[model samples]
Target: MSFAKAQDLLRLALMASTRHFGVSLEDIRAEFSVSHRTAQRMTDALELTFANVTKQTGSDRRSYWKVDDPTIAQLQPHQETAVEALEIASRRAKEEGRLRHAQALEDTRNGLMLRLSARDAKRAETDAEAVLEALGQVTRPGPRVPLNQKIADAVTEGLRGPFRLEIIYSGRSDQARTIEPYGLLLGPRSYLIAKQPDRGAELLNFRMDRIQSAKCLDEWFIPENGFSIENYAAQAFGAYHDPDQLKEVVWRFKPEAAERASEFRFHPKQTLQYQADGSLIVRFTAAGWLEMSWFLYEWGDAVEVIDPPELRDFVQGYQRADFPSLP
Candidate 1:
């Protein structure tokens, strides 16, 4: 191994031994694949000086060195300092180009001193200030909803079963509606999948973002057999739609745009077929008209709806009304 690589390994060994096994020279050398002399040299090189080395005699009359340092006992240089220093340096490097040069200097000094270099210390202080500034900008100067804790309690209630919840849900129309929550759907975003008792059999999905408040009700509900949150959420494109209305909607992508569509499977049910003119045929079902509208809007002129005349008409109407001048 190179000298630098060997030094790194020796440093790691010393750190591990000091932190975990109370800094036994024999343990450091054996674990790090280094000579006793090399291990002794490493201990001497460390910034934190080891004091009171006691010689212990074992059953076989072998001698061992025991390190006694209260500082070593309290401060774990590797775990507490080194990793944090590297992270701070990396963040500063990304945000401020000039800071990277300073961070590099600090990292070198940290390797030698076993503490954050002066530059790294400054970077850390700057990071703290930046964090506080960002927090000040984003944080409202009023009481905020404890969303994470509320979600955790809701999840616990759902898992334990026999639970019903009342949530002040905001709809896509930005109308607030009160409903009894059936269960929660943990999606790319979290959702409360609740049945609108007033609406009758209409399963409404309330985005956690749009939910103003939720309260557990006195009544309990039993989830139906074969009902799964993952399966249900995966069936639709976005959180708002349902998957029960699966109808094969086909679209033809122009040759230039074909590769883009084929690059990633946009939907689990998506199927790609090459057309005669080198174009691509992408087929996937929509749970409702909402997802269909989104797909058509996103693909634009690069895609043409081939099947489901209603979808073609929907796109045509949008084109005529929205972009009448465009071909």
Candidate 2:
């Protein structure tokens, strides 16, 4: 093989090893348009050259090849940031009970890290770690997921499914329901966002832990027309939403808290205005007054509600009797 052909075969062989289902000789031939003999030569070269590469024999005695180690391959400086990102994603997934995804991310991270030695790895790692540390300092941490393995798996599986799953949900008691899943959202917890045509056409959020059992139905359901998960999630102030009850909310922050409040993100679609008086005005339109109220409560006396009487009422409702009155 020419130098270029050798490089191409090495790249192909390395990728094949990452798959649990090893690539067959036919797979290489079909993908790279190489003949059976050429495919065998590439496979043999990979096994002989790389310590991590492996060959598995199928029941038919045909051999399959896979990349035993991707991380062992050297990483360029730009690749360091990509490695750092995958590490963060893996940590996030682990916190959210997505073990399979977390593990996969870690494996990828580990493989990348292996390619670097302490001497040549210094500068790129420092830059990437700095970015990750900044995000860790500012972002509010999500709650550790409380969902069981099976329920978590079901919710994950339903995301791409055209299947209506039969689920036994519990509130006052266990009751059966059929739902066509739209997507899932992860924040403080995980929710399976779906719709039930039997109940109403409106979409609903089901807490993953509350689902007693779920089974996929034989019948498949199509996703709603023009429905996008990104748009759906953007409509909520947080994880909760009252689709029809959305209202514009305004809050004024005192100078002491204005800087901090201005730096925070309360809603996906929110705007801020810094006043000449060093105060800040935060504005957003969304629903879930109770959830909104809970957030504003965190600001204490530093933040003042300026509009939407209902939100003020909800916040006022949480007040304790005999507390110091404010003007």
Candidate 3:
């Protein structure tokens, strides 16, 4: 492709990417059938020439490319409609008590809107309102312990400034705690990932709603020993973790649920294999057998624990019709 053609194709790709989120070099290479070197050149061009080319690093530790300036926003009408559909999905997620996904969709909508000119934002909001009204949709947040903004602010400030924090936790008593705030996870419930008073201890998740009060302390700290929020979050099935309990769990799905089981995403770090006999096997390493059991319970008898007998016993122990008296 000629330089002018490559630039034009890139501009169009960027316009779509700006509304959707961001584009990757792989996207450019596949779309334009260009070399990796050419894709890099396109990214450089977009960064240099665009007014608000910015990067957003999500909790998953992936960087999405975006153009964030209002003056130069270039979302087409169809792109606007697609984003509106996302708004609708956000509303549905909220209604279904999936607040984490609701918050994510809202954030994406806000990011796209932030890139629009003031007039455009107003116009688009009005248009979206009408569209949503026609759809007659509504939503609400999932069940969660009510959050205390003051506590949340203290935790956020500490993490942003890379400082230590002091907490007066009303757990079992009037306990004093100091921590290095790492990351905050907003889900059905919220948690603060931090390094606590003990040195060399693993990062722990503290329920924000449980803390009585929090203060940003002057003592400085940093994420040491190569800690990344993404890596830390990936170490568990859900929110609980203990390094000692980490295990490679394997489960085989009977032929009845094999196809569905194969399609399901068990964990971010997991592997799946289809047996010659038609069963499906899945495995992942994580530190939360108790938590994992909760999710696995829903699969019922369709799954068989192939490795780590402990988890299998835990599951079977709960598969009781009634409490039987022990002899």
Candidate 4:
């Protein structure tokens, strides 16, 4: 067999061992960019080679093969890139104030390294250091709340179960409330996107830091039909979701800052129109004017809010001593 074919087989074997749901023939075909016949042959090869390879049918009635024995998939010398990526990610998470998450990543990296030879482990360390130095992180200085591991785990359970959470929130009110968890919006400051059934079907952002405790109830919830956390999060500038204030926002950048502004992914659905005068007009429909205002202040005189007079007023109002709150 060719060296490349051997490597592919090894990689496929490793993947099969790690994935709980196992791998499908379609998965093999997609992973290696092979034809259906080739994918079938690969599976046959795995069955012939690995004694512990077993096939199981899922709820969808589709059969997939899983390598029950994990030792069959050993770490190889060529997997330095994985180690480097993990190190970089760990450092970034630590810098971002996710200490617990960073430690978990570091632990995983260390465990993976231990599986390799001492020489390979040393080489991986050197390569990771080089990669980190070459690609340094530049983070915005802000309040990055470190999540409580217990609360985070509870929230995860609730989200995965589609279960209601009884949380002790310290934001605005010092009381416990039961909410149907939609999902979590992770960032410098994370939030739990959920709905208070007593209040209405409207979604609310509960700051993660303010959640003193979270208890996943035994009961499960019926998620709203056609509800997607990503789609909901995209409708806002940031975590603060206010459906009432949703508007078509427009901003114009001066000729000098146009190039800089063009490089920014301010919003997923944003569009840019470059003018003859070299100015750039950015347009996106979103909510969370407060968060948007915070970003706009950094641009100073280089940017102008052309649409949504309310937002323009809100931005200008900040300059006044008697500035009123957002409407």
Candidate 5:
């Protein structure tokens, strides 16, 4: 009835036309943040407006709505901003050593270009490249460990299959191992989160650089029940994780640095308490004290360790060059 409603109906039509399996009532409700009744009304509106609209039942026994033609989903010639954004993201991904992600982004950009006429596609690409070149290279501070492209590709294929990975690791010993990949952790040093069935189901981090080679096995595996990469990663402040060394960490930031410190997300589960005197206290439960200490050094005298006497002792000892024994 309203302009906004008209726009929403058109947007819904575009989405329904573009998806291969069509969309369900649940999908409509979630996308539009509408109730079941509203979603049904919107679906009815789409059927009335689009001649190609059809309904089909899914394997789950739920009905799905699809449009036979995707004319409504076609991109506008003036909207080259989308292409430019994808180009920028691809370069950023490459700079971050995420070769797979960069390739995917580039592929998507080329696909979008193919949707246009040959001449228009060439013009769009030339313009996008010009914009990218003018922006110059982005230099990211900190060390970035280069990932082995072949090993990275193998890890990706293994995870997609939920298959086992046979890898040659150059850790303390150069040994061949078969592991189940859970996910990957990308940082200054990238790692593959996997578990060796022979060793047990406990997930461990294996440095990507140390993986001399990887191969995806034909065997499939059921992912661990209730296993979340985010939750596992949250257990540690950085890519490093040591379950046995887990502890509640506390840090107090001086007023001079409190504002800047509050802007940082030191940990996923970290909490902040603003002191009456303007100091800030950050607290979180995590392992990897060594990684945490590395970040603390950046704050210099602006921060102090409030608990975990061992961590305080370690930091203090490291600063004084005594290298105290850590528990």
Candidate 6:
């Protein structure tokens, strides 16, 4: 096996040891299908770096290697669960023809799963296989690209300095344009927030999926003062957010829906008031009409747009047009 693959197996063994036997080297090596000598070498490598490895007396009266890092031990359960979820999601993405994204997610899931117990690893693989089988039947085909890492790196670069980017962007009308990038933003979806030379004064939001190609430019631009990504995202929904687009919206939910809505706060701007009928009146500011539409649609017939005639009209239009009609 490749050294990286072997190392990954070793790490999973180590993690499992911590959870089940307080880091027994013998147990770990056996789990990885490795010899005692190789397992000793692996433990030695970890000891050199973490300084947490030591010999301990087990119930069998044998001395075994152990890792005493409480923090790492605490994360074992969560790490295993997250790895399994990622594996399931990755397989689903693949069956849907999201080849690039699936590969990337699969790689990440494997890497993370290698830090979990053998039992968890086996469970994840089984679940992933099952999910893929189900996905094969129902997944809708779509144009998918592995854009998460690219967007994350680009955003990091932008946040570090005023990094410039050269991007081939596909617009709303499906027209492609080359543009110089400014800042990147994490909206409901990741967006390349930049100004196009042709579209002066308008900071355009380009969906990462629509970006055909991107290159970091030699030139850079300084970010304007008082502009924070967190603040920007808090005020907007999706990728079409602008500082000037904020507007208050009110909605009423049926009693059953109101009880559900009360359990979670949808937005920082959201305000909920209890009605006499045990329903809820929710008020929040939206960056655009698109966000309001999506919020309403998610609730089905449980919600009603109370104020803003435009929003109510828009919701009504979608209800009448989008749903199938019975003859």
Q: Distance from true position, residue 123, model 4, in Å? A: 1.3
Per-candidate Cα lDDT values, in order, are: 0.58, 0.76, 0.74, 0.85, 0.86, 0.64
lDDT of 2 by residue, 1-327 (tens): 688876676567556755676788887888788899998887777777777667789887878777767673432334667777897898887776788789899898777766677654665568768878777534555455566777666666666567788798889757789899888787667788899888898999988767899877777777889998888887777778786657798999888778778778887788999999999999988877777777776666777888788778667645433424322
For residues 1-327, could you state the per-residue lDDT of candidate 6 as single tens digits?
A: 578865554565457345645556676577777888887776666666566666678899865665665555444433545665776677666554445557889889878777768887787667656655565344333433445556445555654556666666665554545455555563234566666767775667777767766666666775566765566666765456755557777888888678787876767767899999988998877677776697567567777888767778888845432333211
Instruction: Give candidate 2 misplaced runs (Cα > 4 Å).
Output: 1-83, 110-143, 317-327
Q: For residues 1-327, could you state the per-residue lDDT of candidate 3 as single tens digits?
A: 687775565564555355666766666777778898987777777777665677676556655567666434453332467567879989876654456567889999998787777877788888888888888643333465656767866877898888999998767767779988888776666788988867466677888878889999998875777877777777777778778768888999878679878778888888988899899999988778887787776676677887777888878755432323211
1-327 per-residue lDDT for model 5 (tens digits): 898998888778877888999999999999999999999999899899888999999999988999888777774434367789998998888977888899999899888887788788778878877887789775666788989899999999999999999999986777889999999998878989999999987888999998998999998999899899988888898887887768899999888778888998888889999999999999998888888898777666678898788789878744322323211
Q: Which regions of candidate 6 are displaced past 4 Å?
A: 1-82, 89-162, 170-190, 196-202, 209-212, 242-245, 260-268, 294-302, 313-327
Cα shift from native, residue 158, model 3 (Å): 0.7
Give, for candidate 5, the lowest lDDT window spanning 10 residues: 318-327
Q: What's the lDDT for residue 286 in model 5?
A: 87
Error of 1 at 207 (Å): 3.7
TM-score of 5: 0.76
Model 4 scores what on Cα lDDT? 0.85
Q: Give the least accurate 10-residue stretch of model 6, judged by summed lDDT.
A: 318-327
What C-alpha RMSD separates each model from the true structure?
13.5, 12.6, 8.2, 6.5, 5.8, 12.2
Model 6, clash count? 0
Off by over 4 Å in 3: 1-79, 82-123, 130-142, 198-200, 317-327
- Positional deviation of residue 187's Cα in model 1 after best superposition, in angstroms: 7.5
Q: What is the TM-score of each candidate against the true structure?
A: 0.46, 0.64, 0.67, 0.73, 0.76, 0.52
By TM-score, the better pick of 1 and 5 is: 5
